[model samples]
Target: MDKERLPRWGWLLAGLFVAALVANLLNLFVLVPTVFPEEYRAVTVITTMSPVLIYVGVWYDEHRQHYWEQSGAHIAGDVLFVVTGAALGSAIVLVAIIDFGIPAFLREVLAMGAGFLMSWGLFWWRNPDVYADESAR
Candidate 1:
């Protein structure tokens, strides 16, 4: 990865985090407050889905080049990454709700954190050379 590309990747990660934060905020402040308590489950599903969707979209766009080179493995890895991230995030939310009795806002925050960590981990695993200097090329 070029030094120049590093900033782009950083910005992309930052944007994903910010988007997750905003989704959680909206879920906590607007959706939950305005909707019926019964619909809270639906709100939770939507908030959880948003980050995974963003991660998939960004990952696909960034790694499209590697798609053709290793189509089967790459696609499978992508699917696994999304599914694992979603499961991890959902588990965090469930645990927070059931075990900790944490508030909605804090639960959202934990979900976002889980999503961020999963996304970063997968991204790093997929792009191990991300920090390599590219000036020679």
Candidate 2:
């Protein structure tokens, strides 16, 4: 893939990651306190899991068609992408908050955006044909 086109996927993935981060943040900061109120145990569980479900669903939707090969290696690589991206993104946010005194919200947004870009780049590099239609750009 051309270096110039790489930014397109970077931005796209960053946007998705930020959306996931925002959903999770909203659940923690607002929905849990106001909408779900801790008094209801089932509501709490639902609220806690909703953001994760949303993120996974969105991620799968974004890649499902491109990665429909169903090969073991493809599945394993996709899983690795999720695990590594989440781990690295969390670490980045934690370090920024603790060491730089950045707000958690800002750190999370930045970390997830960067994580998605990096992870997507790796994924795209591994599967160049996924975005073979450069002419569409």
Candidates' lDDT values, in order? 0.55, 0.51
lDDT of 1: 0.55
What TM-score do all the candidates reach, one by one? 0.45, 0.46
Lowest lDDT block of 10, candidate 1: 38-47
Q: Best by lDDT, which number? A: 1
User: How many clashes (backbone N, Cα, C below 3 Å) per candidate?
Assistant: 0, 0
lDDT of 1 by residue, 63-137 (tens): 434434656887567556755665566555555574567777766566656655665566557754542345633
Which candidate comes out best when scored by TM-score? 2
- What are the runs in model 1 whose C-alpha is more than 4 Å off? 1-68, 130-137
Write one digit per residue (lDDT tens) for candidate 2, span 1-137. Answer: 23354454564565556655665677588877777443222222222223343334334444435456669887677557644655455445445555676665665556556555555555556666665665753
| Full-model lDDT, candidate 2 | 0.51
